[model samples]
Target: MAILSSLRRRSAAISVAAVAGAATVGVCLTVGSASAGTVSGSLYRDPSSAVVRWVAANPGDSRAAVIRDKIASQPQARWFANFNISTAQSEAAAYVGAANAAQQIPVLSVYQITNRDCGGASAGGAPDLNQYQTWVSNFARGLGSQTVLIILETDSLALLTCLNSSEINARNQAISTATRTIKAANPNAKVYLDAGHSTWNSAGETANRLRAAGVQYADGFFSNVSNYNSTSNEANFGRAVISALNGMGLTGKRQVIDTSRNGGASGDWCGDDNTDRRIGMYPTTNTGDNNIDAYLWVKPPGEADGCRYTAGSFQPDLAFSLANGAPNPPNTTPPTTTPPTTTPPTTTPPTTTPPTTTPPTTTPPTTTPPTTPPNTTPPAGDGCYASVAVNQWAGGFTANVTVTAGKSDINGWTVTIALPSGTSVTGTWNAQASGTSGNVQFTNLSYNGRILGRQSTTFGFQGTGTGPGVTATCVG
Candidate 1:
């Protein structure tokens, strides 16, 4: 049960056609991978990730050749789980079944947290907590008996500040139940709670949150998810979190790191315009750290963060830059075939449905091996753990409040923040705000009514308030 590596799949306009009676399912999305890193075991086939697909579509593009050779052909993870239970179940089962046929361990990204992405780039998930529970159960059915890498709910823990109390409670309950269920369904399944990135949450807070989310029952935790935090930095951060967990009597737990986009560190993680980024450590299980298990590419390099291009689709230039400028090159080289097939697979290419947020579009695939599939991180926290940012301009000022669900979710919740006298709310997002000055009752919108455990969400408005020291207090 030693999984020494991880994966990061790319998104695109692609098709994953399931081959009836075949050993594997076809995924249409084309993604690229790192050109450097260690490999504990063979990677699953990814004929459809962004890099591969782009190369296929424009074979004559000279700049893409190096990336085409180094990354597009490399294997990555296949993400699963979405709004529909039946869809998640079928997709997961199909991908797992294909991996079993290839004898390659598959990496699964379970990312359908209710109100996922907290009304951001990757938004929209199961309608409610109950629907999410049912969806997770159905997703577990896909694991079968094979060893699978399940990165549970990316950003679920780190984004706790986005939720209110009731949502937090429900989120914790959801994680505990999902972990137990996935393990029960497949004893060989290795589950890892998403730990966001080092820049986001402190090690102590991350460990505490994971514990509350039932990390004790998981294989371990994962860090630098799709982020550009350097591997060394992430390792240090990960070790701290692991040590904190050990202090809590949670020992023998190991963690996997995503070295996909951390070629160089970034000062602004939320800034989608970052390009100093490069590919990081190759996927391998032999990472030097004892507490740190493996090094993986949980976030494919070329996939946009919804800033430059469509959020998850592939960008050739970015992929090329990452592949070409890799600080440490991979030990192995991929094949030079039209659709690189370093290791020919037996199962057919499986067509897949993109995550619910956006639809995928692709033409066709030459051929792909049946292999296992794939694919967030957390943000920073302050002492109060709950605060808001305000902007004051001349005659008017704007206020935004982020309410944390200290220990539980805010179900059918209401949030109230104090406003200065003579203050009036002009607008807001993801919430409803009313009342004036001292008592502004901000109710939940239908889409974000329920917050996940340890998560938080914000609502803001414009109003006339005293300048500078116009302090505000928020409560959920």
Candidate 2:
């Protein structure tokens, strides 16, 4: 397979539902009898991911719903590729901190090793081994005490052919030091060195390179990070590498496979423009394998691999394709509308569980503003229209309001949402907010202010109390 472009490297509130799924099963690694057993745990889902941002910016696209539910909702590794040594610590801290708040483990990929990607399309990193080591140290220092998984320097070992013997030695030494630095900073953090994919290197050779690059200091090794390889094949390769590592006295190491885009494996490893590749298994600690640590989405799907578009940029159509092609793609069938009922039901089942007795004075009635199906379009008028999708829990809810311009393009727009009596906005993204509750106005940010004719942009907010039955009104 062409591995030249394979190594390209590229939240959220504490939901009670999410925190309940944060329990991770520990696996004891043994050389013999490494059965395919998945562990159990919830990976952190970043609300600010590229797909989420895209979904928020273009909610009116026909494929938005599928992409939103499939790709944007999964947990993927956030790559720390830019060689900004100074702000590395703070950036790492902020991301890990958010995951910590959510009671989930954060998966991070460090892609700035010196000589990364062998000067391929994804090339560029810290100037030298010394600088790379320093950057790694700073990034690790900010990981805090929470459990985090780190995929270290993708293709650093597998693509060693581009370097001279001296350069290879230097690169391995640098990775070794980086791994040690990360482990020393946060013992709770699990570091996995890159072992390339199954198609790139044989198990023994990959194990040898991983050992040389300090696999002994890491949790294990990660494979298929930016490639398209089936999970079963990658797992088998991982077991073989573990066997090799065990023979070399590096026992008890585990592996993580990038199940981001391996649903349909193809020989062409560059931009998957021609292939109909669907997203692989959803990210989780549950890989059902003793030797496999976790099945992660190392490469965020929909990102161009430097072929169809610029590398690392999100393409909505591509994202939708991957999502729609999944084995169990999100339901895209629109709900059929029936004629209006002559009389509203007197008693509707409660959308939320009722309190034992009298509810708190501040709590809104759970039955008020009955749960509406997602993608409900508001009444249209005034050269613009907006739609509301509400995801509600007992005491709180989140709303994604999509504002679309009419026949003419709009330079800017403001959306006024008349929230229910008891509802109040706590946080908002992709737009600026004016009011806390009723009659709240969200104005597009500078970047997302312009909407081409008939195009849409979305802004979301977390709210307290009941949701609004009213559709949002937009003005340019």
Candidate 3:
């Protein structure tokens, strides 16, 4: 098996009626490649309010221990401090304290200056630019040793329709000022200007808006902030935005995305049951891509974004459901595992046959067919010793092969093949393989002894395969 490649599917908005009415549906979905980074965090916490609720609900409940353990175990998940800080100085001090104590990065949502959507479907932000900057400067002061990930005022730059040029300019100025203040306060802080999501903005429009808002002042922009679109589509949109940013001369900047609540892309923009989504990948290490940094679980899975479910409350059941817990089922597509096909060998006869005149002189004629040369390489579907596909098994498979002297052993080799579509690994060996809640793990295999100088060892398994889709590679 070779290194599994990332598959990305763009989420194109299609009408449900059209899909349901079709005789056959061709679903092209991409699987995200396994990455090595972690970002853990709760959506928001109202210390005075949440602490009381937690204590009241968990009195003598063993589940509390489980919850605490789960949260503590994932150190990469940062704790987001999201509350209205009345004064800039106080808010800054509080965040600084939290960062110092946690020894983990803190993700903050700067919301007070804006209308915050507290009363209506789309609320406005501060009418006064001075007040907004004053608040931002205070917010910036809280930087400690720990880094801060600032999601500057969600949808402020987005709701452009409602605001006049003056209002929009004020908004832009506020964001620019906030970014500068924060950076000055903590040079290490990563500030991502919010870009709503793919459904909300076209690539060209987003780039224009980002540039107008002085995007260069901030580290980069963010997308899918609080929406339910698959990571695939978000990634695609992010790439487009990056291109647009580059067009504006802001090259080499990187953006982060909110992968929270989008286990799958939403069917509709608003109120669609499908829009109520779950989470996928967590905050990851820098992607190393020039334009994209990380895919983060910004919105804690299952939290309501004023979805009328519980009026800005966290619905555990809903959260779990989106997390593939209940109601909404998890995607059970199997990993890909099929090998490429090989062509058969061809045969040809000698250019000239013996003349019939020779037959007159000879007493008897002897004809012999030409022999085909042996194929040194392993044939397709043979599962030969030289090249074994490791991820063919359902869960994960491992085998051991011996190598003679003068041969190089391919042992101590590990291959992680993606299971084919509609199938999954039910079991594994040499180590334990487990598949729970849509995640699969393979471990603990032994491969020992060197092959003779030229010999080789091989191990592999055959499980399921997936996708009619090709692998996705990073362009740059």
Candidate 4:
């Protein structure tokens, strides 16, 4: 993303190249100052996280220094939205109570969509709308007038395509009900809804989905949650969504973008390797663009995005990479009016024949163990690799894939896998794809588009896997 600086500001211009991942951003770096850690007016230091607990227990390990200095030392979020029926109320009360005691506003992640994750890695939510309301009621009771920033759901709108009309209606009802419940409990709470990212849906499409899901009751929308899309890309994408919302007669809408791990935007959404990841603009209210409330660490650094380790496990080494690699704001920003890149069939370099003898560069290793145990093993593969499966049901299954560079760094990859006579791509995560001409063409998301030599990234689809056999063809 490019930061527009007044040419009069010499320091910002010199600092432009100072950003850790400046080269990876499409818009050049040029930003004003910003604050670090949690948002200002916070009641207290961040609640102790898994990393904090680990540091307290494993103080002697070499990584403990970095963990303590970087990951454990900062203020990040505490997710109270996971499926923990027995503890939901108490946990919610405890978190808010702690923030209350410290006199700080709290930040919470509330994933309350009835069917939550679409049967993907982070799946499960309240069984139905009634139960969801009960759960949200318990959650909201804890906020009681304290200032807070609430991210209602990470992918609430994206689920529209996977559900039938009845299911969609139910989901929207659940969202609207939950929004009212939260607001009724604490009218001062700043609530935001999900808009996926610049790459996931068009502006009008996202605005329509947000409206359906009850944007009227929200502070605004948020984008790039738990993904690595560029800040500029997300900023422009967010503005577009906001404009669309306003065009529909909604006014004074605002947005928030996740800056936790976007320091570098290689578009590596599905890859576990994050050495290239950089720190983004710190959480602050002084965002140059008034439409943006703040640039936040929505997905805490060091937390694995499923592919790297167990989904959401906090990795210390990765955390250290994030802390050490991020540039202090004066950071980067993208244009508000920029349009999103079009998704379409595109040309990529040809794949080559491999001898049974020669080995390709190894995919980069994921970081050390996280607070939660991590599965650091990368999917074993060669240059430009692919893998597929037909195991969901009689007509459905999940497709897990991998792509590694040949002899040098790669900017993009295209993997075309032939489907059986009746199979088609129904949904995807960590990347984008289309099913046509009897095959599925999957490509990288913007932040994960470029990969270093030997480093790899992955993407997948959920669709009709009708074949008795499946094969992959890749180009990088």
Candidate 5:
């Protein structure tokens, strides 16, 4: 079995020369920057992932190059599937702390529902709902106020067919309580409930189930976890579910789709040792679709699904096959226009004093076409507006700036922000930026520049210091 091969290589010490050469050549040859189409480069990549450890242990392996470039480098959710009630808090703290230190959003998957997997191959969870509730609270204690994305309990809602009516009610109530508990513990954590995949349930039925499981309290629902469904199908199904939720007076619910392992066939195949499957769109929050919040890898690509290996175990052969089968990486050509060339103001800023200039390295903007065309009609008032929402920690902060087209569509836009003193912008995603200190400028990338009338698009940045008095303005 592939697991045996992996275990054999686990203790081997790889030399420095092998690591450097593979890192350079493999990444350049196989994968480009995660900026085009569905992949966003902003999410956090776990340095010590299963695939990473595998690649490190077996640098000389034939399949190491492709797996290193493709699977190990990408950001995917880290699942907390064990029932470690006593150690949950510390474990959560260590993971979330690493992400916070790197100033990137962490994607966490909580899979300890009462009857996980319906006593199938991937069985065992909290003993009961009450214990599960306590486990959730303990886990939530470690999610400290940073921007985090939580995928709650895969198969919890969709696999309810096996449960009795009373059991179903109990599960839903537990989910509801867990949602509230996590949110209350860390307001910045974006919780998403599972809604199976596109082919599993009708859109209306899925929405009904989601609501019954307290979708009202969550940021949104996620679909296609550990399943091989196309992004388009899942996205369409998500919109239909949102429509159903809207009909139930549960408006403004967004959705995320798991693009992992869905790049190939969109069938009901699960736990099958199939080599035809491919990795889906790279994880990204800047999906260009308004209804879809992100395309995430809730299920890491290299891990087996209870077939060909033990469930949740990393298999290098499977990882290599999936990477080999993926479509060519998206073209990452820069937009025709250059980064903002406008000169910074020579005089003192109005809102806050300037800080030491530490400009972030510039990255070429992607040329992927926008998913939604801008409204051509002129607006009644201003062409666009911009707003800023900030989350701060001890010495750093992250801000999400939203640009809204007013009344009509906008062909392009430039947003300027006056950040508070002592703050310097360090990194950004979904948009190109110029000027790192007080009064920074952000311009729309080729794919996200155009927006429909009254619709909004978001871009975010990380900064070194607090930016409480930040103000932003948009010009279209």
Candidate 6:
């Protein structure tokens, strides 16, 4: 609801400003950078679904392989650890196991703090604050190294309207305590408290909440963690919130956004009856705004937010629909309409006249012409293409690819590279890759795999490159 409200305000402001300035401007000048990133993995759930069941059923299925490959291909991806405090220990163990076994990159998003989603749509968190803090501390301990980009709680600060003063204070204290505990546990961990988004809370109000929650102790705040608003709008909103925070003397704080489902911002609220909206943006670590740390796929793109199916249940169909851009009108099957055809009659008349003609031949002087070929090779080490370095490690390979071409920007482009035989790609970044005998194909590997242009991203992976003396070729 807060996100929806914020989006409404943005839409109105943008519209009014466009109309008022249209006369002088002649054309509407919308100024903003696009977001980029890749949504490689599904929202990991303990209980499997139809798709997951299928993946489990077929051990080496190509579809399952593609999904795994896509996930393993990306170096860093935002993983939402949605386990509640009640099951925090087990969930944490499972998470650790998955991280260790997969050797996939981890960027954790810790949800389940305070009343999630303002008690409107989501299952609320710990009935008391102490339990919440305990859960958070345990969760932090579980995270060892593996550089976590922790989203402290979703909508915790934004959903403060429902709580009384005492309740609010208690909740804020709990968050502050949790922040200190997590940071103490892992100094390398980048903890981000949720600041909701611009559409949800005014900059001043959100800043007040962040201050109350002790944002100073944390890395910064997170915005648009699980909503569908454009990164540009979210960035502007984040800047405003940060500015307000700075005004409140909370300066130099940063924020990250959930770019998992916001390919484009929705015009309506979460539960609005309107069905014409489509999902925009994929998942990646590229943020258009420099101040924003990473545009992570905080919300698993296709996971329903307690709407489409029995509220809070994982609906794979809905997830898939949302992933592939949620087309409107629920279940409209027809893609196109057939056009009627009209045929025209054809008539031909032939008249032949025979005539003898003598051909005149003229001899022209022959000279050898100079031949030169146009330059076909691209400029060396340009942004258009990147030559990534792959370091073959024990069970897999490790490499860090630096992009100076589109640093801190998201550009839509694909990355193609080849890997050596017997070496299956375990993971990657900025894009998804499918591998054959010796050739590994990366498709839709945009800047950060899902970000716009002018951004820099790092992807690393480990794989069981089969056979002794296994090697891989990094060819784009």
Q: Which stretches of candidate 5 lie over 4 Å from their true place?
A: 1-41, 266-272, 325-476
Please say which candidate is ahead in TM-score: 1 or 5.
1
| Cα deviation of 163, candidate 4, in Å | 0.2
RMSD for all candidates, in order, please. 16.0, 25.7, 30.7, 22.0, 22.0, 29.8
Whole-model lDDT values for every prediction: 0.58, 0.66, 0.43, 0.57, 0.66, 0.46
- The number of the candidate with the highest TM-score is 1
Residue-wise C-alpha lDDT for candidate 3, range 299-416, written one tens digit per residue = 4443343334533344444443454432211133422221112211111000101111100111100111111222134323312223221211122222221112222323333223
Task: Name model 2 segments beyond 4 Å from true.
Answer: 1-40, 329-476
Task: Write the number of the candidate with greater TM-score, choosing between 3 and 5.
Answer: 5
Worst 10 residues of 1 by lDDT: 368-377
Q: State the displacement of the C-alpha of residue 360, model 1, in Å, after optimal TM-score superposition.
A: 35
Clashing pairs in 5: 375-409
lDDT of 5 by residue, 1-476 (tens): 01111111000001111111112222211122343232243577665555655676676899987786667667777777667789889888988997888677788888788776666544567887656877898999999998788998876776654575446645765786789789999988889997877765667777767876777779889988745678998889998989988887677788888887777863324423667788888777777787777788777776655435554556788888789856544433311211112221111100101111221122111111112222233335758877665544456555656688888789899988887788898777667889998788899988678888897666667677775343567899
Q: Candidate 5, overall lDDT?
A: 0.66
Error of 3 at 334 (Å): 28
Each candidate's number of clashing pairs is 64, 8, 43, 18, 1, 43
Tens-place lDDT per residue, model 2, 148-247, is: 8888877677665567544654576567667867888898888999787787667877887787666777889999874677899998999899998888
All candidates' TM-scores? 0.62, 0.62, 0.52, 0.59, 0.62, 0.52
Residue 383 lDDT, candidate 1, scale 0-100: 15
